[model samples]
Target: MIVGIDLGTTNSLVAVWRDEAPQLVPNVLGSVLTPSVVGLDDQGQVLVGQAARERLQTHPQLTAALFKRHMGSAQEIALGKRKFRPEELSALVLRSLKEDVERAFGEPVEEAVISVPAYFSDAQRKATRIAGELAGLKVEKLVNEPTAAALAYGVHQKDKETSFLVFDLGGGTFDVSILELFEGVMEVRASAGDNFLGGEDFDTALIQHFVSSQRQDKHFPDVNVPGMRNRLRCEAERVRHALGQQPTATFSLAQGGRQWELAISQDDLQHVSASLLERLRGPVERALRDARIRVADLNEVLLVGGTTRMPLIRKLATTLFGRFPAMHINPDEVVALGAAVQAALKQRAAALEEVVLTDVCPYTLGIETVEQFGRVLESGHYLPIIERNCVVPVSRVKTIQTLHDNQTHVLVKVFQGESRLVKDNIALGELSIPVPARPAGEVELDVRFTYDNNGILEAEVKVPASGEMHHLVIENNPGVLAPQEVRQRLAALAQLKVHPRDQMVNTTLVARLERLYQEHLGEVREMLGNMAGSFQQALASQDVECIAQMRESIAHRLDELERSPWQ
Candidate 1:
């Protein structure tokens, strides 16, 4: 079966179209939401989801989270003694979700439809597909998250004719999509967002507040330490969520027998997050302008992603549109459900025979060239072949002549973004096509860009005179892997020893104790060490009741010690 996966930054989920409707598939923990974290335990076994997240506090050096932000880059994150690319880390999460789907269906799942942020670049999209391959699944398609959400909403209201805005603010990325639905057809008019802006920025704001309040900047165990930062980030996440329902929440962190606490109000969160809120406005305005639809003309504004749960985000929407945005569907699950719907559509499911979906390229695709100004030839000009918001599965061509006589070859430098200058845009790839040398402005070559439904771009340069054609092949880009490298990486990932899911209860507690041991000193440190030893002995006995009792006793004691300061 082709399952749909939303490989998110903070959390991920899997869903399938069963019983003629989309249904979520729960993990071994019986929860559909899986924390997007990966780590290596003390046993040298890989840990994922909640288990890995717990280790982030206790074994920060061995755990990695938020790697999604580096998806299109060559940045390698260190987990203990080994380092891994973002795609590889994402592959581990996908593999875990793949297991969940198989367990739910009592069968193997080999193909999937994965969802990505609407504003993800071409290289990022390719990296996502490579991640799927590494996870032992065929990537059937890459659906834009907002487009998927709209498709899910459109399928339910098949006959409704309306134009709406999709405001998606997730853990690590933000996207604004404008769409129109009519007669069972959903069309994306425009898409815009900052790949770097998201809910995590709010967490950073909260972290800064606690840092300044506590004056921990000069502490012996500096707050900048990985373990300390993880502890603070975890507490900040809680306080941020709590402020959504209450006016005030306390941010607390414990280390070296001392507890630091700060009570913050919702107003404080808004004030600190003011700059981030402003970043949201530019994308919204740009999308609307590109779609040529006025805010008043929009039939509705649909909110998607878990970050939208914050009252502050919702309030911003209300102020911008003069009406509260619709949240009829669960923001976190909506995209996954939509992805499942897309998967079913790809299967040509009878229930979705009437539904037709379409999406647009989120950024402009062009090449760098020189423009003549009087007698001087100025370089670095960007000539767009395919403009942003153009419907996908699109092919656009532009013709240009040789810059100077005896120019035996034409170089095509491909780029993506809205910048008028090539220097300001993202370089995808480049190719040099040999041409018959001719006088200046005489040898014309045709450059064509074909953007497929999956958002992968292909560039071709053709010499009409000689009928010679060259295709752009991207190389040396750290984000993209060649066919041979992909095979090697796949084999490398297969050799990792993953910890069994059933052992997470024991493993998580041990990880927590290790974290506590490092945070304490004197008698407390020795006591925690002994307590961890006792729990290991209980596990070795293979007595269920004994292990349970020991686990409970240690857990309670740890909680008590964490809450109370010690001398």
Candidate 2:
């Protein structure tokens, strides 16, 4: 009765607990995917999923797909008269998914376990919870997408205690996770990802290719259109998707009303995306450095997301890791399945308590200070306050001598990133590690970093001699705007009738959700029948109130199902 949903930045998906396993549901289009799109029809009614996505090619002005990128930001996109905020738009996507699940079962769905990126901050995670609430289904658990994927792979066909890395490259975000599969338990040892990277970068690479190929093509062409840039961007995306396995893809684009056809080989597409592909190495390398391990030590490199289907990605991964990556679980649907299992466990629906998943904070959180060389202490130095891949139920304490003799209080600047320079990184927040005046190196500043089952970081600094203690989380956090702020700006942005953009989370969300829905139709249908018999009849009898009531009832059932479906 309960399903797991992966609300990705470029796409979305829904799956359910089944026969002691997780299965994805498919949409009505006979594909295990539905685009995460929404648009006003010609008649002013709203259309979502595949239909909304189709409108993108022609009705680019009205449709909005891939709004997930703006999740933690204060960006607001306008569609029509309604100035829907990101959370509201996200809720609409979840609502559409709810309807899809209902159609699959002819009953109402009430509960769900949703998956989000492991690196999502508290604000982003909270926003996701609210989106689930607005959709009328209870959120059983907010499982991290990477961790879920790990569980989906690690939980069954089980493994002994061993460490493996998960390379998750979706359409909008990329995450590298190291996990320890131990005695039926899946624990995240460390995680790092780039929110701005993924399949979208590949599209940009291809766009660069097209622009380069046209360097001197003077075949009656100025190559300009009011929306030429956007059109080329769309075409580039199409080509990237087509070149997944095919040796070649031929795409003709009409830019500025002038048509140009390019016969792109896989090699050509690969070359275009080479730079973007190159960018992934930094994060992957940084993560390994943080984990203090080489790729050769990994037991397996599991790939997650649709983009992993590409040949070059696989080749690059094999080249870097010196081993072939594992595949079988649908890259798009695995996260959703793992989410469902997590939901079931959270609700106590399954006897999986022995299964423990410990995830690490993706970003290094610390206070800023200057080095003797006039260097600044930055967040991404890879000198983790708590090193990545250190086993859980662990805490580390470090002490440093005060630099100044007369310092009464020390100012602390916290940051997140892999950069060495303070100016080149993100400031998480600021703090003052209090200390009494003393000669240089006379006072010891004690700092402790502790990590729980979840990877959230909390810092405690002690001026032991003065009995002064500073307890706080990481600082300099501008990564995610507050929810109220995102909402307020989103409402205002709605009035301008700004064009809906494809940020990409919606694209991945659609693909993932559709795949999940199709895999778990049988259980979903039976639950729908049991939850809304009268409503099903009303749907047939044209009774609005009964249908609405049944809808509410189905949602409640889903909520219950989400808490613990197997139980």
Candidate 3:
């Protein structure tokens, strides 16, 4: 069966349509959420999810997390002895989710609908598709995360005609989408976001505060060390979560034979994270402006993503919209659940036969042109063929005159972005048309861009005079993969080996102990080392009861270490 996957920044999850509703598929750990982390064990076996995440604290140099922020870039993450592209790591995560769902359903699943940030560029969207393909799943669709969340919410509210705003703040990306539901149609009016903003930034803020405070007290660890920085990030995340549930929280760090304790208050969190809160307003305002709707016009504001649980964020959203945001669904799982609903719709499920989903191009599609303004030749000017927020599966044509006398050809350089300057926008592709030589303004050509629902752009230049057309299916742009490259990468990724599923629990425990062992010194270090040795002996025995007891002892020792201060 086809499923929906949320390949998130901090956590990934899978969901499928079952019994007329979307149901989450638990991982081997019996948890719906899997930490989006990838690493390698000491034995050089690939590790994913909780196991990899635990290694982050002690083996930071051998682990990769939060690669989603670099989705469209050429950046490579160095994990253990291997180097991998962001999409490659993402492919591993998708493969893990695929394996989980298959094991849970006792069947082989081959297709899926994956969710992405609504504001992701064409290159980013294409990268996501390539990742899915590499994971051995046929990606039928790439649904915008906020749009998917709206669908998950709208499916239950079919009887009501309403307009709502979806504010999505995930681990590493934030997207704001305006949607309208009426007469069995769910339409996305506008979407905007900052790919670099999200829950991680809040963690960074707290980390910085602690660092600055500790530096003043002269007791901070050297954060330049990857392990130390990751440890602080872990503590920061804990503090961020604790502050969400209470007025204050304390985080302790052991560094250089000293224990440092920091108390963070809710007010301190708001103060340190104020700038991030402000960044949220820009996208919200832009989405509303593009939709031509005021805050009062919105029937509701829906919150999505785990970050929205922060009281300060909720308060800010309420203040901006003049209404409390709706939390009718679990913010973290809603996007994946909606992705399942979309998958069902793709299959033409009987329950959603009347539901129609329409999405818009989040940015304007245009071409660069050189125009003569009363004797001045202006270059780098953007002439929009299709405006932002225009419903997709759409085509727009704009006729332009040649810029110079006797111009033999016209060049159409396609771009996508909201900027008025072509240089400021993302270049998609270009095409040159052979035009009949004529005086400026006498030679005309039609430049058309067709943006499909899959977020792919196709550009065509038509010379009506000679009935000659030049067409280009925009692909292989910078940061995007060529078809050949995608195939090659898929083949390479398919051959990479993951740790055996049945041994994951034992592997994870060992990795955690290895990390904790490195974090301690003196007696504690020796204690952990002995425990590891004993656990190894028990594992070699292959006795179920012995292994279980050793596992419990190791867990208790680790817990005690976490609570103990450095000597």
Candidate 4:
């Protein structure tokens, strides 16, 4: 059965269309949300989800988190003795979710509709598809996260014609989309976002504040130590989550024979993360502007993603739109659920036969050209073919003549972004075609770019006189993996053994205890060690009830240790 997956930054989830509704699939931990983390255990088995996330605190050198931020780059996450590209790490998360869904459904999942941030570049989107391929799932479509959220909400509100703004702030990316639901069609009017702005930045800000505060007291923890930075990051995330529910949160850390404690209020968090909050405005304003609508024109503001759970973010969004945002669906699950809806739509499910969804290209697509201004000829100028926020499944063409006399060859360099200069934009690919030698400005080539609903681009350059044409499917670009490389990596990843699904809960518990053992000292360390030993013994006994009881006890004890003021 085909399912939908939200391959998120902080957490990932899967859902399927069942009994006329989308239902979330629970993982081995019996939770819908799985941490998007990957690591190597002492036995060199790949650990995913909570277990791997916990391992990040004790074995920083052997774990990777937040690799989503580097999806399309050359950056690699080094775990143990091996290095993995961002997509490889992402593939592990996808595989874990796929396994969960397979076990839950008692069937093999072959196809999926994966969601991505609306503003993700072409390279990032491609990486996501490759990741799915590596996980043995055919990615049928790459739905925009905000668009999926809108679809999930709009499907239930199909009776009304309404315009709404979707503000999606996730762990590693932010996206703003303006959508209008009229008749049976849900059309995304405009899309904008900051790929690097999200909840993680807020966590980083808090971590910095704690570090700086400790430095002032001369009890600074060496953040450069293997696991120290991750420890601080984990604590910072806890504080961020705590402040979401309460007025203040306290954080305590022990390192290098010194203990540090800090209390951060909600106000303090807002003040520290003010810049990130401000950054959110740019995308919102740009989306509204692009949609040719004012804030007052919007019927509602929809919030999506766990980051939007923060009161500070809610306040900022309310202040911007002068209205409270809607929280009808769980922000974390909305995208995945919407993806399921899209998957159903793809299959032409009877329940959604009348529902039609349309998306927009989040960035401009163009070609590099030379512009002549008086006596100066400026090369590397970007000429737009399809502007940003334009409706998808669109075909736009622009014609240009030869640059110089008897120019026998014309180069077509395709790019994406809204920039005046080509150098400032992302170059997709380039093709050089030979043309019959003609006088300057005599030979004109029709450059056409077609962007489909899935956000994939196809560029074609045709010369009518010579009946010559060059077409590019626009799959492999610089910085993105080629098809062969993706297949190679797929085979390599298939060989890496993932920790058995049945042992995930126990593994997660032990990883947490191990991390705590490394963080504490003296009595606390000894206590954690003993508890871990008992848990291991219980696991050896293979008594389901006793092992479960031990796990619960150990988890509660770890929670107590984490909350204790005395490190």
Candidate 3, 1-567: lDDT as tens digits: 899999999999999999889999999877899999998877777889999998998788879999998887778889866788888899999999999999998999999999999888887888899888888989999999999999999999887999989999999999999999999899999998998999999999998888887787755567888888888888898788878888988876776777787888999999999899989989988999999999998999999999999999999998999889999999999999999999999999888988899999888889998867897998999999988899998999999988889989887788888888999998887777799988878878888888888887778888888789889666445577778978888887767677898888887888888877766677887898998899999999999998988898888868776654433
Give lDDT: candidate 2, residue 365: 46
* Runs off by more than 4 Å, candidate 4: 217-219, 473-476, 560-567
Task: Please write out the lDDT profile of model 2 over residues 1-567, one tens digit for every residue.
Answer: 677898876678887776677777776554556666676656555666666664554556666777777674456666655555566677777876776677777778888888777666544665677677667777776777778888888777454777778899998888888777878767676777777887877877787677777778776334353234445656677677778747877665543434566788988877777777888898788778877777778888999998898889999999889888998699988898898788667656565656776666665544455455346433323234654456654577777677767777776555555466667765555677777788877888777777554444566788888988888643344444455755664454344331233312233233223322322345664544444454446567656666556555655655565333221
Query: Candidate 4 lDDT, tens digit per residue, 1-567?
Result: 889999999999999999988999999988999999999999999999999998888889999999999998878879989889999999999988888888987999999999999998877888888899888999999999999999899888888999989999999999999999999899999999999999999999999888777786755757888688899898899899989888988877887777788999999999999889889999998999999999888999999999999999999998999988999999999999999999999998898998998899999999999999998998999999999998989999999999899899998888888889999999888888788798899899999999888887888989998998889655436458888888888888978987887888899998888888877889989998999899999999999999998898888878777766546
Model 3, position 109, has a per-residue lDDT of: 90
- lDDT (C-alpha, whole model) for all candidates: 0.90, 0.67, 0.88, 0.90
Q: Indicate the worst ten consecutive residues by lDDT in candidate 4.
A: 472-481
Query: lDDT, candidate 1, residue 67?
Result: 94
What is the clash tally of candidate 1? 0
- Looking at model 1, residue 111 earns an lDDT score of 94
Show model 3 residue runs off by greater than 4 Å.
216-219, 473-476, 517-531, 552-567
In each prediction, how many residue pairs overlap at the backbone (N, C-alpha, C within less than 3 A)? 0, 54, 0, 0
TM-score for each prediction? Answer: 0.94, 0.72, 0.94, 0.96
Q: Which lDDT tens digits does candidate 1 get at residues 1-567?
A: 998999999999999998888999998877899999999988789999988998888788999999999997899999888889999999999999999888778999999999999999989999999999999999999999999888878887889898979999999999999999999889999999999888888999999988888774455358778888898788788788888888988887666666667889999999999999999999999999999999999998999999999999999999999999999999999999999999999999999999998899999999999998999989999999999999988999999998879889888889898999999999988888888888888888999999999999998888897899888897556789888988999998999999997777788788779877765677988999999999999999999999989988998999898656332
Q: Cα deviation in Å at residue 207, candidate 3?
A: 1.7
> CA RMSD for every model?
2.8, 11.2, 2.4, 1.7
